[model samples]
Every structure is written in C-alpha cells, then in structure tokens.
Target: MAKAFASQGDLAEKKVSFTEVGRDLWAFTAEGDPNTGVIIGDDSVMVVDAQATPRLAGKVIENIRTVTDKPIKHVVLSHYHAVRVLGASAYGASEIVMSEKARSMVAERGQEDWDSEFGRFPRLFQGHESIPGLTWPTLTFNDRLTLYLGKRRVDLMFLGRAHTAGDIVAHVPDENVMFTGDIVEYHSACYCGDGHFTDWPATLEAIRCFDLAAIAPGRGDALVGEKLVNEALDNTADFVRSTYRPVARVAQGGGSLKEAWDACRTVCDPKFSNYAIYEHCLPFNVARAYDESLGIDTPRIWTAERDLQMWEALQG
Candidate 1:
C-alpha cells in the first residue's frame, strides 16, 4: 500500500474535551474522533452516540460523573455504525433507542461494518474484545419519538439521510440544542462511504431550518451559539457537495474511478485539506460518489476484504 490504510497509523491518544453546549447539555469530544453527547435532565440522563468500545465509553461515563450523579436511563444511537453503537452496553441504560431504519441496517450490514471499521481504524476500537457482539436497540421508532427525562424533553427524529441511510438526530427543544450524529460534522471529514449525496444537502437544510442555538456534532468540537452552528452546517454541506460534484461529473462522463478520484481531490483538497480524517475518508467518498452518480441509490456494503480491495485499487 502507498500509505498506512485508513487511521491505523494514528495511534496517539487525542485530548478529550467535555464542553457544555447548552444548559446541562455536554459534548464529549476527543479531537476528531467520534463524539458522544450527554443530556442531563431533571431526573435521569440521556446519552447519544456511544463510543467504539466499552473501555472508551468508560471515559464518557467518568466525565458524566463529574457533573451529575444522575443515572443514565437511556442511550440513544445516532445511527447503526459500529464505531457509534458498539459501546452501548457500557452505558447499562435501561432503554437503548434507535430509529427503525437504523435497526434494519443493523440486521442487514452491521457485522460487515464492524469488521470493516475495526480493520480500518484500530485506534478507535481500543477494546474490541469487549464489544460483546453487535449492539441492538431495545426500543425502535419510525419517524419521531419523544422521551422525557423528568421535565426535559428529547425529540429523536429521522431527518432524511446524509452520512448513512438510517441517520437520525436528537433535538432538545427546551435548549434549542441538537445532537446531530454524523449528519453535521464540525471541521471534520464526513464519512460518506454509506452516504447519499443527493439526499445529504436536503437533510442538512432540514437541520438548518431549525436555526439551532447549539449543536453537538458527530465529531470535532462542540458548536455553541448560532453563528458557529451555522458555520459548521454550511461547511459540512460544502464538503458533501464539493466531494460529490466533481466525482459525479467525471463518472457521468464515463471517466475511470481513478479519474473521478483525482477530480474530487482537485476540488476538495484545497478547501478541506486540514479537516480531520480527510485522507481516511477521501477514496471511499470518491468511490461512493462515482457509484451514486452511476445511479446507485443504496450504498454498497463495505466488508474488510472490500475495504482493502478498494484501497489497493485507489491508493496502491
């Protein structure tokens, strides 16, 4: 291979930050690693997006203890990705919640994604053996589900698809703060391997329509205040559009996948070269963009073997 595959070379631990985005709402961010949201209510607590493994999730629990000793009654999965859902058991929450489509994706491609991601990013899955099989939601909802942690209200809604087919967001109406799971990244690369390019912008617009005061994004720092939130939204939309347009143009014109990759790099690198995980996400993003342009609506399942095959073809 031309370079270390994905984030295998990134072994150094990142500086973890627990920032309060809104009243009693905390965001656990580790540089550009996947983030977890903590919503403390009048009684119990609700967690969003469990980390990659039990050991990693323990860190979030430790942070949670610093603030309030309230029990974590619910764990909400933003999507069905292994990195986001495998650490669910660590929470020990009575109710594990996910959108119906997300649970279906788990039934469809969960293990394959687990194998693929564990191989791609070893740093994220520090305690892989502790994952205790695939994480399944005890509770599933179709479009929207409202849960109350005492007086605090959390609205978990499926606001179209962007990063994945079953992507969802947790909105706290009282705080005007949203915990957007991979849907809105802040200065971080969007993992579009399972994404829908055409549907991404519209999904982003739907979040924008809310005019949120704060957002705990899937990765990077927590976005507090309306201006920072809007910036992240605009930048994320730009990243998705920029990656897709050039690759789509190349593919529609009968260009090779390599050609499409080069075209996407030309457009995306200058603008997003400094973004977190930019390199790790590029080839897959380009390949998916090519496939989407060729009229593939659903993203192809990524297995460990397929990841290597695609990486060798693009990076070798």
Candidate 2:
C-alpha cells in the first residue's frame, strides 16, 4: 500500500461534547467521531448508534448518567456498520433494535466488515478485545416500529437507503427531533463505501420532508433548531451529489479507478477538503461511485484484504 488509511494516523483523542438537542434528549459527540443519541422517556432511556467498542460506549453511558437515572432499555442501531453496532453489548439494553434489512446484512457480511473496519481505523476500535462478537439485534422491524418509553413515542423508520441498505432514523414525535444515523451528517464527510449513491438523495429528501426541528446526526455536532437542521440536510445532499457526479462521469467514460479517484478529487476537494474525514472517505466513496455508475446495484462487501488492494490500486 502506498500509505496507511487516513484514520490509522488519527490517534489523538477528540474532545467530547454532550449537548441537549431537545427536551430530555442528548447527543454525545466526540469532535467528528461517531455520535450517540440519548432519548429519555418517562421510565427508561433509549440510545441510538452504540459506539465502536465497549470502552467507547462507556463514555456515552457516563454522559447519560449525568442527566437521567433511567435505565437504558433500548439500543437502536442505525445500520450494521461495526463502528456503530459492535459496542451494543456495553449498553446492556434488553432490547437491541435494528431494521430487518440491517439484521440480514449482519448475517451476510458482519464479520468481514468488522475485520475491514478494525484494520482501516484502529483508533476507533481501541478496545476491540472487549467486543463479544458481531452484534445482533434482539428486535427488528421492516418499515416502521413504534416504542414507548413510558408514553414518549419513539418511531423507528426505514426512510430509504442512503448510507447503507438498512439505514433507519429514530424520530421523537413529541419533540420533532430525529436521531438520523448517517442518513444525515453535519460538517463531516459521509462514509459511502457501502452506500447507494443514486438512492441517497431521495433518502435525504425523505428526511427533509419531516422538517425536523433538531437532528442528532450520525457524526459531527448536534444540529439544533429548524434553520440548522435544514442547513445540515442541504449540505449533506450537496456532499453526496458532489462526490458521485465526478466519479460517475469518469466511470461512464470507461476511466480507471485511479482516474475516477482523481476526477472526484478535482470536484470535491475545493468544496469539502476541510470536512472531517474528507481524506479518509474519499477513496471509498469514489470506488463506490464508480461501481454504482457502472450499474452495480449492490455494493461489494469490503474486507481487510480488499481495503488494502483498493488502496494500492488507487495509489497506482
């Protein structure tokens, strides 16, 4: 490989921020790292997107403790990414939730994703040894499922495929706040290696239709108020579209993967170079865009070996 993954060199710990995005709802963000959402109902708490390891999850739990003593009874996984679901056990929630498609993906490529992510971003999986295994959901719903944390209705809906085939969003009806797992992002780059580029914009529009007041996104800081929420949504859509267009144009021209990479950079760099994880996500995003442009509907599973091979090929 010409160079290690961008995440491999990111060893410095990020400053953690636990901000209240809505009444009784909190967002645990670590600079640009993966974020966790907390929804406190009358009797219990529901968490969204568990961290990558049990140790990292402990931080979210610690923050949750500061505000509410209610037990975390439900842990909702937005998708099957190892970075988001592997830390589920740490929550000790009796009901671990995921969309039905997400659970199926776990059955198909969970281990490969675990190995691939661990190899690419060692810093995120600091306590890998503590992860019991591939995290599986104890509960799942196909389109939508409603859960009440003692009268606080929480709706989990599969809006559409964006970040992954099974991406879902948690909406708190009372507050009109949504915990959008990777379906929406703030300033951070979207990790689209397993994404659906063609379907992504529509998914964003679906979320937009909700006109959410606040959003605890998959990554980046919590977006509060309608203005901020809209800004994030628009920016995310722009990011997704910006990334795909150039790469698709290159691939449609029968260009090499390296050529597609360069093409994507030419367009995305000037606009998104300062975004968090921009460098880390660019290659994978370009590769997926290239594949999708060629009419590949399903994203090929990324394994550790494939990550290295793709990196080397792009470097060439």
Using TM-score, give the best candidate's number. 1
Candidate 2 residue pairs in backbone clash: none
TM-score for each model: 0.99, 0.98
| lDDT tens digits, residue span 1-316, model 1 | 3978989889999999999999999999999999999999999999999999999999999999999999999999999999999999998899999999999999999999999999988999987888899999999998999999999999999999899988999999998999999999988999999999999999999999999999999999999988999999999999999999999999999999999999998999899989999989998999899999999999999999999999988877
Candidate 2, 141-213: lDDT as tens digits = 9999999999999999999999999999999999999999998888899999999999999998999898888
**lDDT for predicted candidate 1 compared with the true structure:** 0.95
What residue runs in model 2 are displaced by over 4 Å at the alpha carbon? Answer: 1-3
Q: Which stretches of candidate 1 lie over 4 Å from their true place?
A: none
